[model samples]
Target: MSFPEDPIACMRSLQAEFGDLAVLEEKGQRIAFVFSPELNRRVLTDPTNFHSRFFAVRGGRRSAQRRVTSGLLSVNGSEHRDARRIMMDVFAKKVLPQYHETIVGMTSDLMADWQTGQLHDLNEEMVTFMVRMTGALLFGITDGEYSEELGTRIDHWVRQNHRVGMGALVAAEEYTSQYEQLLQMADELEVSIQDMFRRHRQAGNSAQRPDVLSLMFRAQGTERELSDEKLVGHATLTFAAAHLTTAHTLSWTLFLLAQHPDVAARLQQELDSCTAAGVPDFAELQNCTYLDWVIKESMRVLPASSYSQRVAVAPVTLGPLNLPAGTPVIFSQFMTHHRGDTFADYARFLPQRWENAKPSAYEYLPFGAGSRMCIGASLAMVELRTILAVMLRKWHFQIESGATVDGRVIATMLGPTSSVPSRLIAADQIANTVPVHGSIHDLVELPSEARTAVVRRAA
Candidate 1:
């Protein structure tokens, strides 16, 4: 069967064929697909039983960079716990505050030189910014000139992994070729990371490490200091997870806004009122209700990862099926987000749906649910909020007339259908090059203005 890897098509087919869940086996391979909210929760809440060896790659379990467990995302059981603890130090409340400047500075810079009336593809430029910003946040690599170089190395390795993963899904005989390419790219990236890490270590006296590298290095007291191999492992995973996710999330948000000019107008008014005096701090981000709604609706319609999978270690029951051991159980956010049974007219994108709308945690697993949920969910929220606030405050973007913006699913993430959105443009060519002021909510297009306050809740 020629299963198209295009995400939207694949998801629609799965939903129509299997309702919420189904089982598929081919060539002696067994896979189970789960779209039910309850099952999504069960798989995550109790990951140990289901386990996570499901991500093991063929050339070996080592990451694309060939590092061992460096961070929490790749490991399971006690090792994951320990890595999480160490990484949490930087992500802890204290460190996030430190990031406020970095976030604002990055966004401000992007919007500063934007010019109006020029046909610019903000998605591509924004992706570069997000990728660089993630590297800066996680590894303290802020130099834009160097950001591209570093991002290139990281991107190469990630794409290689994606190629291999897709090959495995289709049982392609060329899997070995893809795997070999993945290993080669990983080796190249490994060297680059090592050099960077060494420099950061040598500059320890400067107290200038702005990324997670310092945190991992200092995580020694939390049971163990990260080894070079392990440090690269975690860093590589962070690059992949944090970079593309942020970029895609931002692009999707723009895409949704472009479709709803009225919503964009309201959002702009809200930000305008909220920021009459100055930019909104992390605290004020919570009160941007309309902004929040836009993100929610966007994710519901086109989440970065529409489908996630797991393997059952023991026979278990899900809905009407008795899933056996080794079944590749799959869960889909695409279907769940659009299930008419749960969400009315789920196919349509409606930000208002989230206003005064509170669904069960299970019903909205855009970030996945339970223990194995996206570790950077909170961080993503903050990043998204910050970027959106800055981008909207400085300039407004709309899908260019006749611009074809489509989606193609590539493994765990989504990419635009055409290269137009990915093109890089000077920021000076965008409209509304006005400097924003006061709180973000004040500047937004809200029906009524509201004061900005810090949102301290952890995601």
Candidate 2:
């Protein structure tokens, strides 16, 4: 059968037709698709049975210039464990507290550029903000110039990657061109990472900052002395994964809040109660329970990493079906998150659902679970909560009437197809407006004065 036009719909159709473990032949290759949480857990947790090399190649081959540029996502066995352990030191709980001040400061600096009445594509804006933040955290690059440059390049690469899937049969010129461009960007990025490494080395241990780069440098000559290739690979993966996923999550959360004013108002109230003049410290940010629920619900609705892929390393039984070695296995966060059995009123945006019910890791694998779980999950959460808290406190947003906000799968993550067009009204201006609760449809009908304010400021 020809590949379905809508990938999401295709997955649903397959599940409906063939049950949870559906096998399909595409382009002369046999692949297994899994939807239930149990199978997803088995595929993700049992790396020995299902290897991640397939997903790693999703970005294309490792650069030949680097002998060992394969990052943790691409590697398996002892190497994966060692690299993950070394990297975890930088993202450890203890180090998270140190990043709080930096993250808040970054959010403030980004917000400073926002003009009250001007229309903005929150999706694009969030991507820019996250690129800068990740750059600082990963490489100690305070100036956003390099980060912005990298972000633009990465966007191009991601778009191209999505467009040109396996590229085994279709050899279109556009695909070839995009693939070349992607490789060139990857090369440029590697050079930039090497420059950062060199600069960090020259500065020496005494002058080193507490960023991820510094931590990696400290590991040199030790058992964890990652090869230059591995270092570059880690840096590239972190830059792409860290910013893209978190930015998408933030954008979705903001959009959901705009659609659900009652939720936004309640979230803001919680923020106001815990924060001083709208700024929350790390402890206070953690205490904003409703804000956490909003984020969780947003992710549940539109996950950043939509789906994950693995290839069977050896003949294995997945549920009732037997799969041969080299068979590709697929599991989707989008499907699992929307499962009716796991989430009631799955389509509705209800943060309250999480207040009492807690799903196990198998049920909610937004960042994946077990040994191969995302190492940056902690840092990503902290960044999301802190950024959202700061932004929600400062502005009330309204989605542009008639504008479409839909998910477009780009590479591994799902983000807006285009700009999530919306207008930002300064919180002080809306503080006096009557609070509207319920569906975003209701919230879009702003008072005449508020509408006038938006137009007036635009003028």
**Candidate 2 wrong stretches, greater than 4 Å:** 1-5, 54-69, 158-165, 168-185, 202-208, 428-459
Q: What are the root-mean-square deviations of the candidates from the true structure over C-alphas? A: 8.7, 5.6
- The TM-score, computed over Cα atoms with residue i paired to residue i, of candidate 2 is 0.87
Question: Which ten residues in a row are the worst by lDDT in model 1?
Answer: 449-458
Task: Provide the global lDDT of candidate 1 against the true structure.
Answer: 0.66
Candidate 1 lDDT, 96-170, residue by residue in tens: 666777898888887666666556665677678887788778777767767778887777766666566656755
Candidate 2, residues 1-459, lDDT tens digits: the string is 232234566687888898888987754668688999888878888978887752232444556323223666767888788888888887898878778888889988878878777798888888888888988888777779877886666566545554544442233345545555556655776677677677767767623475777777667657446777778777776776788899889988887777666677788778888887856788888788888898888888788888877888899998788898878787888888888899987767788999786888988989988888989988988999998888878887777764544566656677766677778787643323322222222212344433443454458
Per-residue lDDT value at 394 in model 2: 87
Report residue 296 deviation for candidate 1 (angstroms): 1.7
Candidate 1 displacement at residue 173 in angstroms: 0.2
Scored by TM-score, the top model is: 2
For all candidates in order, the CA lDDT equals: 0.66, 0.73
